[model samples]
Target: MTATGLTPSTQGAPDPASQAAARPTAHHPARAPGRLARSVRRNLTAHGFLIGAVVCFALFSWYPMVREFLLAFQKTERGRTTWVGLDNLTTVVNDPAFWQAWRNTLLFTALALVLGFAVPFVTALVINEFRHGQGYLRLLVYLPVMLPPVASVLLFKYLYDPGYGLLNELLRLLHLPEQQWLQDPDLAMLSVVVAATWMNMGGATLIYLAALQGIPGELYEAAELDGAGLLRKIWHVTIPQTRLILTLMLLMQVIATMQVFVEPFLLTGGAGPEGSTTTVVHLIYQYAFSFNNYGAAAALGLLLLVLLAGFSAAYVRLSRTEEA
Candidate 1:
């Protein structure tokens, strides 16, 4: 022991300043390489899994879109390709069918919104309110969607025939006027929309049904307590609750009906009487297949793509804003 009566090693506490100086910092330079290496390895593995999808999109989707764009600005003749600037676009824009196709497309979209959007929603509501036989009703509603497109279109064509069709026969039996369905230029587009709604509405109905099942029953109870009638309850509680799905479905219907082709092609020979049902997509098909003018087809298709893309972008922006 030292003469001061303390062990030699216990004579003084360690220096706090020296201990603090010896401690490691949170972001030590020596540990950075290991962390960076691990991050790079993880990213490489993730990208490896995405490689197949990237290749497929590049080969199929992106390449075709780019080719279509290029074809819109170029012409092929005598096994040669040459840039034609805006010639194809100018030709397409000048065609009278161009405006008619746009008008028909817009009309079809409007009709589809009314039928495709509302019918499914209302059907869903009815189906949801059912205390029994829900499964059977759902099956009946969805039966049409299971049919092949060609089969459904042909079936509707038979029904819309002016003479000897079941629909006309039913009208005769019911004492309703035997009006021309597909044969009438005025009603041709409407008939096509009806057939389309019948065939495609099952999907939307099922989607709406799913959404309806998620709604809280308390909302309805509160609406009832507030003396709301059926329609008022729907307007105040149901629509607001399902507004997102409704808007999304509305946009989807617009896009689908705008590009409608198969029903019109099969039912009305692509243009009906006086070119009534000639849609933009049908016109593109005519340009490409019937007239053998791929340049014009691509140009028209590019325009349609641009317009639809704008709508989609607007929807995306609105959805984002709502989320924010």
Candidate 2:
């Protein structure tokens, strides 16, 4: 009411604090359609890739494996499938031919392991010891791996011809008996083993050579400085250094050789003169294709898968133990 306390114009006007509080807030545009469109596009992009990958794997790998597994319990008669349970497995196990095929596969694996395993390792070491022409030597050793198995098997078949083969001629020149390379029941497996070793050794030879290249030259040099002879250096330094690769190769060779097919299929008429060279794979072929027993073939195939699994498990455990 007093003149000094307040004027009429000030009393009627709005407060400064009230005017500041009445200011407008910020506004951002929310275009629902644009946000929705972007979200859908990104979601579709991610899910499309995921679905495509799964479909590819299912079509190529998973579906075939499932069918094969199911076939183990099924029989196909003129394109009709019927459930047979464990009958196929039992029948296969009871067959004398099954046992013979197993024996041949095992023997072939042994022979192959001997030649396939040792020859490559020894050859790799010899190549590694030299300080020159390693590239050329490696190529030469791996050359056989590039050859088609059919060509090599057929070539060996002629080389193994009974009377006129190069093998017989060489034996005659040395005054040795001209034994049948693939005719006799006892020697048929050996002939297959020889051909297999020749055909397969090249890949392993190069693998061993690569493994050998990783070993330090210093170890061998130190051993030599310590008056170690060639054999001693090899025994001490070389063996231990390349032991892992060697073990892995041996397991792989055993698993692969157990499934021997091409050499016997092409060279020996699928089973040789008798069933002497009939491998497990060849036997499976006989059951599935020749005999038309899909169930039994599946049973044998599943059995082979189990055997290979065992070998693989053992190798993996051994490698883990080595690392530990």
Candidate 3:
């Protein structure tokens, strides 16, 4: 204490520890490494997860597609590769089988849409109505889809045999004339479509069944109140509700049927009678494997790609227009 003051005030003085705590320290330059390391680790982890898929797509899908495009313009002849320019395209277009293959592919797509699209929807509708055994019925329908494709095709071949096939036998028993199923040019494509529809329709049928189950029962009741019959109810409520799914399935069926090769190849020996079953894909197979002409095969494949792309674009445009 001073003589004139009771005590000296420490209120304005700063604490040494507090001042030191608040003081800014010099930059170490080491923290940058720590932050950079953390960023690198995070990026590495993310890329590690993505690398597998990237590699797989690069190896299997993208590489093959790019190779096919290259093969379209290049030719391998007598252990030498040479650029053929548009010669391969010209050759593919000029081939007599090319147009025939397109025609057959289109026909197959049309028939598949009718049978594959309609049969599944109808089957789903019928199955949806069953109050009992729906699960068992669905299982039965899906069983064929689970079968080995080769085995199914072989079984169909035997069943389609005109001489001793069960179908002809049934017709004969009914006093109907036995008809050649796959052997006749006129019926071979139809036979293939029927078999394909039977084999592949299970998944579509189940999808439609799910769609049907999602429909509001109140809508059906309202429809009934309006005096709408069964067909009218289907048209007014069911079909409209399921239109999107139907359109998707229709596009899927078209693509599947257009690329059809295994069924017709195994059923009617690739070319069918008089090349009636020679679809575009089958023709491509013949070009690549049978004739050992990769360039021609690629060219034909490119053509099919263009056609399908155009068809899909037109369909989407039309759908949007209708929606608008």
Error of 1 at 79 (Å): 1.1
Error of model 2, residue 175, in angstroms: 2.0
lDDT of each: 0.92, 0.87, 0.92
Q: What is the C-alpha lDDT profile of model 2 across 1-324, one tens digit per residue?
A: 688767556766888888888877678977799899999999999999999999999999899778778888998788788998988899899988899899888998889888878988899888887898988988887878898887888789889998889999999999999988889898888888888888888888888888888989899889999999999998998889888887878888888888889888888887787788888898889898988888899898889988999989988987898799
> In candidate 1, what are the lDDT values of residues 160-247, reduced to their tens digit?
8889888999999999999799988899999999999999999999999999989999999999999999999899998999989988
Rank order by lDDT, top first?
1, 3, 2
Give the TM-score (vs. native) of candidate 3. 0.86
Regions of model 2 farther than 4 Å from truth: 1-57
Q: Estimate each model's TM-score.
A: 0.84, 0.82, 0.86
lDDT of 3 by residue, 134-242 (tens): 9999999999999988899989988998899999999999999998999789999999999988889999999999999999999999999999999999999999999
RMSD of 1: 5.4
